[model samples]
Target: MLRVTDQTMTLAAQRALGARQARLAAAQATASSGTRITRPSDDPVGTGEALRVRARLAAGAQYQRNIDDGTAWLNTLDSALGSATGLLRQVRDAAIQGGNGSLNQDGRNALATQIDSLRRDLLATANTQYMGRSVFAGTSDAASAFTDGTPPTFNGTQGGTVQRRIGPDQTVRVDADGGAAFGTGPGSVFAVLDSIAADLRSGADPTSRLTALDAGMSAVAAARSDVGGRLSELARAGQATADAATSLEARRSGIEDMDLGKAVLDLQLQQTAYQAALAVTAKVLQPSLTDFLR
Candidate 1:
């Protein structure tokens, strides 16, 4: 009976040691990884939640990048439009000077040259390139937005719009068609400029050309207003995107990022428990309880 009791006691001690070792390994792993849920088996529900938040965080980051790229494109376009506006004003001034009847033929010709140069400058602005892509062109990056020098042409296929993700399942188109921004109908701004140049060459009255120049200026102003409206829209959407990204990051932090305070406390608790377990184990594995009792 004494031998049987000793064997039973030894078996119980071994089982207790095995359980303590398993717990110690688990605690060490948790501390080393700094995560309670290293795998699905560790904490299935927590891991699932983390995976979902991680996916959203990834998507939000991509959307932020898209918003940045879209805004950059719009900024380049705004700069080009500003330059074009200045060129138009120069053309208008030259046209006014040409209309002065007091000026001699040589003076009129000089004004005509200025107008032509200004027209070319305007064309260059329209064809402004950003990152090897024409800012005014809808989508085709390889070709210039305007083809004809005397008169501009939209080399792009049709009205194109660029989409930017501003929020969850929300996207906004942030560009206007080149045709609408410039002109399209017969006797359009380009046609009028072409006529102005022809009349100056033929030594005809500059009055009609001057009137057309004023009208073209008005058209340009209208287009600029349109662009300004779109820019405002993009500005609003960009702000919303930024706000959403901030919110998502906050959510991800709440879901995944470890709390240093909680982690530190947990680690200390695990260490204390492990130390206690080791002390008890040493006592149980000792040669004989009588040796200590004595």
Candidate 2:
């Protein structure tokens, strides 16, 4: 036969009541918040995975922003190049007109002045700035890229490229060295323009010097093409990074978020079981003194 004591019965009833209250509170919290896991310990592995995915998404978003900033900087330089190319063409035309014997000394002088003005414009273009920093200054953003004194100095450092990470393990370099775009030594755009200006002032034959001007023109066009290609590459990389970030965010949501429907159902079942346990425990705890004495 099984034996029961008053002390044991009271303890059992108290445990059952405490369990029922805990279940009720859990059910209320789930119903109000619609979440199964409120803390890290609720699902440690899932939470960790979610955090990792979120971090990747944030990194990708920042990479896209970097690409935008880089593109804007490059576009500013490209616009200046366009203006320089147009001025060079004008100077070439003036030189051709001045070369003709039909034009007098005064006309030649006027052409020389125009060439000087165009040279100044080209120099201005080379010194173009973006947000107080010279775009063509290479790694020297604080100094002027071009100075008009003497042989015309480029006060910046050597050509440098910048890289941005746009994916989990992928990075893209989106900058071109100023020297690569503008050339070095005698083949540089500035050097050619200087030669043309000097020749125009000294009464050189425009028809003979026309070949040099054409080469300079080609170099400018090539630089423009190079910038365009880089722009396209940046655009493609930015789009890919954005897509990747979106995918990661969705994956994170799946891992971190709770299924409201399933959580609610489970809470309801737990509440019912807890209430039944409380009722049975209360009945078992109620005992008569006469029954105990017998």
Candidate 3:
């Protein structure tokens, strides 16, 4: 048999009121925070999913940064190669003029001087830098890819590559092969230009030099082609990363963001329920002789 008393009723009402207050507080927190989850305990599985999404977002941000840097490096390299090719074309023109047998000594000397000037310009292009790092240096920390001399020597590394990780499983080479583009040692294009200029000054035909100049131009064109391909690849990767970021952001929002209309309605409902509980408690826990005696 169970007996109902004032003391038991008071205790029961206190517990009921505490429970209502807790529900009200939870609703207020959800409304104020504007999130579906005010605490991890509210939805442990959802918290884990949100955390995983955020981690992926952080990694994607880093990948985006890598893509930007790699693009800059490749663009600079492409521009340098383009300039090198144009200079080679101009030198080829001057070589053709110097090879004209009917042209006199003075004309050859003038053409030789122009070729020499073009050689210096080509050298400068080979040593192109971006953010103080040589694009053709091949991972070498040297200030320039080639040193200035009668036959400029390749100061950059051979076979070494500079690369950037654009994704967890993807990497792109950013630096160029300086030695391949511009032949190293005496076989270099700089030396070839010097030979042409020397032959021009001595009244010898430089038509033979044109073949080697064409080879140099071909090498630069090949390097540029490779760069263009990678740039295109990076462009695709960047777009994909951006799209993934958008989708992931939406997913994260769905997991963490509250629906304002629904949240407000829930909060209002909790407030009304708590008020009703308070009124019911007040009515049931009426002051009695026992409370007065105590």
Candidate 4:
């Protein structure tokens, strides 16, 4: 049996008061902060889980940013490809007009001048930039994908598709292959346009020029189709990323957020217990003969 003495009683009351005060402080902190498990010691397992969830949320946000940037890059490519297709169509029309045997030399010269203007426009479209980077340069730091020369040589790297990571293990190509879309060296669309312009100026037969124009048009159309498909895939991936972020945030909230109603109730109960303990301690530790003697 524990011996009952003034020292023992005083010690017991102090311990009781300390425990009640600790409980009250904890409840007050939970209510004020609006979060449970303020410290790792409060709920070690829950804290770990919350930390993991927060990391996942951060990753999801980064993926979302990547998706947005990728979408912009793809959209720019699509617009440029569309413009290229339109320019090719204009060149095809001019080729057909110039093929007419009845057209005079001056008429062919006018058609050649128009085609030259369209060729310059096509070159500009190929060199489209986004945020200071060439869209078709394939990771090259060059300002333009093609040099403006007789046969417009490709200055960008080949087969170096730019990519963006949209998930932990998934990456999506964000740039088009400039070589495949615009050809290289003498086979390039710009070269073909220059050749047609020269033939028109020299009054050469338009049959072969028409054939080359059709082939260039077909290539541009094919590239546009490929970019459209990639846009669709990126849209789907973006939606999935948004859903994942939402789910992750919900999970993190569950682990870290406190229930205000429950916390307030608990705080009131702890306050009452602490007040009661303080009143009882005061009565129990009143000045006695032993304390006075000590």
**RMSD, each candidate, Å?**
3.1, 3.8, 2.5, 2.6
Q: How well does model 4 score by local distance difference test? A: 0.87
Q: Which stretches of candidate 3 lie over 4 Å from their true place?
A: 284-294
- Comparing 2 with 3 on lDDT, the higher-scoring candidate is 3
Over 84-193, each residue of candidate 3 has an lDDT whose tens digit, in order, gives: 99999999988888887878999899999999899999999999999999899898998899999989989898778998999899999999999999988888999889
Cα lDDT of model 4 by residue, 79-104, tens digit: 99999999988888887778777789
Q: What's the residue-level lDDT of 194 in candidate 3?
A: 96
> Which whole-number lDDT from 0 to 100 does residue 164 have in model 3?
95
Per-prediction TM-score, please?
Answer: 0.84, 0.79, 0.92, 0.93
After TM-score superposition, the amount by which residue 152's alpha carbon in candidate 2 deviates from its true location, in angstroms, is 1.3
lDDT of each: 0.68, 0.73, 0.92, 0.87
What's the lDDT for residue 259 in model 1? 66
lDDT of 1 by residue, 145-234 (tens): 778744556775475665677667777654545665566544456666666666666677666766666676676677667767766776
For this target, which candidate reaches the highest lDDT against the unseen true structure? 3
**Each model's number of backbone clashes?**
0, 0, 0, 0
Model 1, poorest ten-residue lDDT window? 180-189
Model 4 segments more than 4 A misplaced: 1-3, 287-294
Candidate 2 residue-wise lDDT at 15: 87
Among residues 3 or more apart in sequence or in different chains, the pairs in candidate 1 whose N, CA or C atoms overlap within 3 Å are none
Worst 10 residues of 4 by lDDT: 205-214
